[model samples]
Target: MTFSPDLTETLLRPLLRTDPHRPRLTWYGGEPAGRTELSTASLANWAAKTAGLLTDELGVAPGAGVRVLGLRSWQVLPAALGSWWAGLALDLSAAGAGFADAVFAAPDADPEVVAALVDESDPDTVLALSTHPLALPAGDLPPGARDYSIAVRAHADRFPGVPVEPTATVLQADGPLGGDAATVADVIERARALAAGWGAQPRVLAELGVTVRTTAELVAAAVAALAVDGSLVVVDPASGHAAGTVGADEQITVSHPF
Candidate 1:
């Protein structure tokens, strides 16, 4: 159950080597946001492009925090991994998100809320995601906010990860259940533990709400799925698709439900 402490390398490099084209993520949502599947290579490419945006375009450095205010969709995976690719941390708190260097918001997020968050966090950059099935950029962004979908497309498809910092802070998931600042190695260790608990389960599904922001639920679920050589399925619970239906269709073996 040993794993690489470098989160980016642990998540992408091995998958790229072992089964690049194998399906890794499947997302199901409501109409116009149906089904989307990303292969290992596809997912890596997306993360790399996103990393390019963070590093080359936005000047995000290692140990910086990127606040993502979005639902559990296919895009979040790439966004999270991309942050890791740039050696950046993810701040998944429901509050105090404005303190991060950059912020990503979903379209469903209330404009007022986003504006307030921007005022509160006063981050240097804010990118609004349309969350379309086709991954289209938002046409009408809030003032001073850029469109993430459009910006990410201009980046390269591959990114050499930043130097590994196993002990560096990578996540902040302060919550009522229990929360702490975790390092890259700590996250990898937690993933391995979750994988061990899964035993022979083949696929891990994320059924938690976007509001349930926790490192264990967000990062660990995907890592554990990959640790077991299984795909991670992220579903929007309000997508008109039932959990049981998706589990049955997608061959889900385990779930981190709300």
Candidate 2:
């Protein structure tokens, strides 16, 4: 039976929570070169197989937590999903964020550990971890450990992950970017490009959309508010505007525009 996401986390209590490993996040550095796809189906497959290692093989308790950190490789995608499906409280942290990243109850692993994530997570809350690789600001990051990066195609792209709540928090955090008042045209243009990958009538996921004319800015704000979990902060255009206030708590999954 497809697990009902409606169950208040209280009754579910995470004892029976989980996530799939494979979900692709194409990697891009300076310019576009090649692309990679990390599908959820593949992630879930590996997550389930790996959990067998920890539970039936190694004897990691029912609710163990792991601190995850690493390079911004696409591999982190599966590591996060795998951790969740195994019923573990996965703590996602950046590599050099700060001292806070180094704390108790956090295990550090690269994205390669995707499907195996849940096996390590049990008893404790099954926290999800993911990065949208968007050019946006920082959103709510699951407080945990340092980050890392591994070579691409290190492990098998096949993992069997468990089905999770539809509304369950999947991925978190975006790389970084700048804010210089975009125009409505730009907003629409980006929405156009995003539509190429996501869908035609895509909904933006964001919090603040200040500028007036740019389509990227306007549609960005609209899509975020309409489709994703976000809030629209209407600011006074006359103030000349300072840098957009970015909070780890207020951000959504995708990164801001470039």
Candidate 3:
């Protein structure tokens, strides 16, 4: 498969055309009930809805910043991809998240933390995910926040917009290692490099909290899998399952601490 340098072109379009029904992401939360699988077509649909939410409802323009707060979960997939679809820079670090144009938080996050975020960053929009296994609407949220599960349902499955420019910054992070940023082109290149050694159709296993600190790392892992016409299996340490166990169960071809 020819790899496109563009983030969306590389990650979504090609896979949708070639293998839309193939499972691209399978997340295990330690139990059968916690498992959530998304095929390329389904993932793209959610991403499109998320992009519509940001662009049409929130009025977030291309090149804006979107703060994403959450552990590694199935929810992060759409949030990351959707942000990219909308041409927004994804800020995975909490250091200056409040200053972003919008914020997306996990459903089970502490209310105090959410309140503090609202107070500190005072962003124009705050979206809280339900994180429901079935993608149901969340019950309640912090003041001034909207339920992403409900809001996103109203958006179309296909995003009605042009793809983002390759030079646009897609990810930003402030980690213990240091502050980092990458453009769309940079992300594609990094993903290609990461997958270069992995054989064809590599099924990559990556754990959140264990190996991934920023959403950018997860994105890279997913893109790498996509580039090879492969798949990504994500395990959250919080799920209480060992990475090796999940990797074995998924028959992963490669494991990377992205």
lDDT of each: 0.72, 0.31, 0.74
- Candidate 3 residue-wise lDDT, 29-73, digit = tens: 732347789999999999889889899988998889887776544
* TM-score list, all predictions: 0.86, 0.33, 0.84
lDDT of model 1 at position 178: 24
Overall local distance difference test of candidate 1: 0.72
TM-score result, candidate 2: 0.33
Off by over 4 Å in 2: 1-24, 28-34, 93-258
- Candidate 2 residue-wise lDDT, 1-258, digit = tens: 444321112111232233223222223221122223333344334344434433443344433543444322233334434444444433332332222111112122233343233344332232222233332222333333112211112334333333444434322222210132222233224434533443322222222223322222332343233222222222222222222432222232333332
Error of 2 at 196 (Å): 19
RMSD of each: 3.7, 15.3, 3.9
Stretches of candidate 1 off by over 4 Å are 1-5, 110-113, 120-124, 175-178, 208-216
Candidate 3 residue runs with Cα over 4 Å from true position? 1-6, 30-33, 107-113, 120-124, 174-179
